[model samples]
Target: MRAGRGLLAALALVLAAPGGLAAADPAAEARAAAESLRAAGNLLSGAEEAKDRVAALTETVRAYEAGLASLRAGLRRATIRERAIARGLEARRQELGQLLGVMLGMERTPEALLLLHPSGPVGTARAGMMLGTVTPALQAEAEILRAELEEIATLRALQEAAAGALADGLAGVQTARTALSQAVAERRELPRRFAASPDALKSLLENSDTLDSFAAGLARDSGQGPAEPGYALPPLPLPVNGTLLRGYGETDAAGISRPGVVLATRPLALVTAPAPATILYRGPLLDYGNVIVLEPAPGILMVFAGLAEVYGATGEVVPAGSPVGLMGGAAPDAAAFLKAATEGGGSSQPETLYIEVREGDTPVDPAGLFELDKD
Candidate 1:
């Protein structure tokens, strides 16, 4: 009974700190994310205004994405830890068996017989002392064995729980996504910077053959007043929660390279503006799929492409951290997520965001402009 109770404590200690038992622990992050998820869920279900609902659900979806990532990392460590403990036990099987046998013999032997050593009182005293010393050592190993088993049970339970939390989390995220879409459609509070010229936009779309030409057209037509030369940008985080998969100028299989960074993210991951920017355009463009063109400063264009959905309107000035869109691809259900999590790096993000930073029609590396360690 004591061992059973202590097992939880042992598990907690192991998972209490990030990078504690493993080189890359995520348990602590996962716990914090779980709390955030609950709060966001409550806000999503609350009777907030449509505009507020959009904001809440946007953040809620992001929280779930981050939480799911953390859960994946945590579960991997637990699986590895369980297997390591089991292997260690197996390696010591013979020694442990001998210890158990000695312990059982000691328990059953009468106290009088143990004291009446054939050698004499002094010899008997020495033998008794040796038994006393060895007994504790054997008991200690048994306790360790019991504790390890308990930890294994806890790890198994954590995996089982992964299914429930991940399922509910994914489902809740979908609900939030639906709610966000409706709320965005109903949103009318955002003030427009300028009215987009439908004719110019249509002509540009019809004539442009590549992303470069499209961006150049948008830059010339974007109604942003002027670039403030002193508009200093603070260090920025990525527009979405994702892993940086390709750097600027990374040549692909065809030996062709684009002057942009690429990020890989889970399906339906929420993307936000890295800084306050005026939306120059938002829609499908030149095979890039759903795209957003933003004028962050004079002569500076921040283009985010390959989205599943785009929010806001052309010429709308969206604030920093405002949800802009969601990444493409079908989100995995809870069971699928758990299965992939346990498989050790099996879950590869299928959705990719192509990010381009343009300065006066020329594309350049934006990696230095944002925090790279965030991944």
Candidate 2:
């Protein structure tokens, strides 16, 4: 009986060791993860807002420059070259009138006014003939006027040429303004995206040493049980409301297993968390566009793909139903991802959303969890 009791005690210790190792508190994991996810989400959210402001400012600067160029062009077009010519012609006409008055002696003697009329009837006819003969003098005056007018015309031409060059310069300034605005916009966008650094995440995933080290610290006080059966796990709230153009699961064009689900929605729609979780990774994968991976619990991970912009960071936690990032097609309404050729003759492209579930190192049917709650 003593030997049997000792053997039973040994067996009990052996069994207890495994349980202790596997023991995890789901609630605690969820809380810790949720906090990380939230931080990641906030970082992303702030970045996105900054991006929007920059974009708007860029557009405004472009518009202002455009209007400025147009105003310059209009001023050029409205300027008159004729005014200069008119002033030159008026001066010449006044000089010719004075010369005629002096030649006719209409400006002196006993009857200066009478000189303009004639001395008598015979003189009147002679004066009339003299006036008619003044055509030669008038012709000479006109020749001088024409020469002066030509000079004025040349000056006017120069003015127009200068205006055209000024207009060109203004156009160049406008182009530079546009380029500068766009550059600033891109510069602003680059830092947020660069700082999060998807490449770092991919590296971490590839060589788990660093991540494992980090995870070790997090796991020190870890309390979570073995993963529960993934059933009726609510489909992650789409960044925006829209139809799912493509369902989860299928061979992609490259003949690779479509790793996750796709949710089709409008451009820039906000993608949110499916459940409380921590961002295990926030970066890009080969086929995934702007990927975000959130671990809700041990053996359960959520992935978001084809993000126009990402809003989360590694080591950040989020609450269930919190905003992850916005969904984006091409514009306000369009699909971002193309469709794979169907087995049937016709082709189908859908705005797709991808989700995946993993248990340890196994890929299970994600549909099971999504389908369970469908009404």
Candidate 3:
């Protein structure tokens, strides 16, 4: 009987050990989701093209929304677990109190008094055995109480971390909302290439195979005569403040060589006319998103591509520093850019704008002409 009781006590102590009661980390998933959303926001803020801006902002918003959902779900799970822990802790406390009470009563009574009273030797012997069994059981209960206390502390910390994440998620949503609003507003103000008859222009575009062909056709149909000579290049301002991502003549991953300089800038960065110029074309062309071609001088053409939006219309002359368009800034999948940069052994190219200068049909090196230091 004593051996059986001792074995039970040992099992109880093992079950009450610290490792036995550990719960899974409640905040891990939420933390990961928050980090992903933050990375997406960083990429979005680095975008510099117009066609990419709305799409990027929309993705940022979606990520924020998803993060918020994850946070809420984490809070709910934490709340439920907290309630369960509280109930379990309370029950353990009550059990501990009962055991302590009995132990205290026994301690107060003298051993001599117990031996002299009632059933004498047999009663005292039985009491001694009971004390032995109770002592081990009491120790097991005390260990369980300690473990529960630690568990509660861990849960509270997880809850606090979750709350902080939730607050950050809310702030991200607001930032995304403001960015989206600005992008939409800019799109609404942009001048249309064919405001009088868009259908006629669409028909003309459908028949043209290349952007240059389209520009020539439009000019001929509009009755504009051949451009005159004697035009000189003006001092041009940098379209955006950024680092050169890729220079002319550099070949990219797909074996395609760049014909112009590609600048990587902050998301939604304003693109302005470098010199007083007339817009020759403004629209999507080939793989480029929104493109804007300008004539700063006769026979010298400046081309801006990979924009999120274009501001001026065909044949409209605009002064230097006039807002030509905006760079795309939406970071829909920042991870992809990061992965590509890592795998390609290159620096991250977040938002990029391609600028090409042409003399007739021949591409020119714009690096020699533009004073980029002023930006």
Candidate 2's TM-score reads: 0.36
TM of each candidate vs. truth: 0.85, 0.36, 0.42
lDDT of 2 at 299: 50
- Reference-based TM-score, model 3: 0.42
Over 268-311, each residue of candidate 3 has an lDDT whose tens digit, in order, gives: 55577788777777889777789887777655678889989776
Better of 1 and 2 by lDDT: 1
Candidate 2 local distance difference test against the native: 0.43
Model 1 TM-score, 2 decimals: 0.85
Tell me the spans in candidate 2 whose CA falls farther than 4 Å from its real position.
1-202, 205-240, 333-350, 371-375
lDDT of each: 0.73, 0.43, 0.61
Q: Put down candidate 1 lDDT per residue, 42-159, tens digits, no spaces.
A: 7666625544666676777777676677777777667778678777766766765555455445546676885678889999999878766765554565456566676676666556
RMSD of each: 5.6, 34.3, 14.9
Best by lDDT: 1
Each candidate's clash count: 0, 36, 15
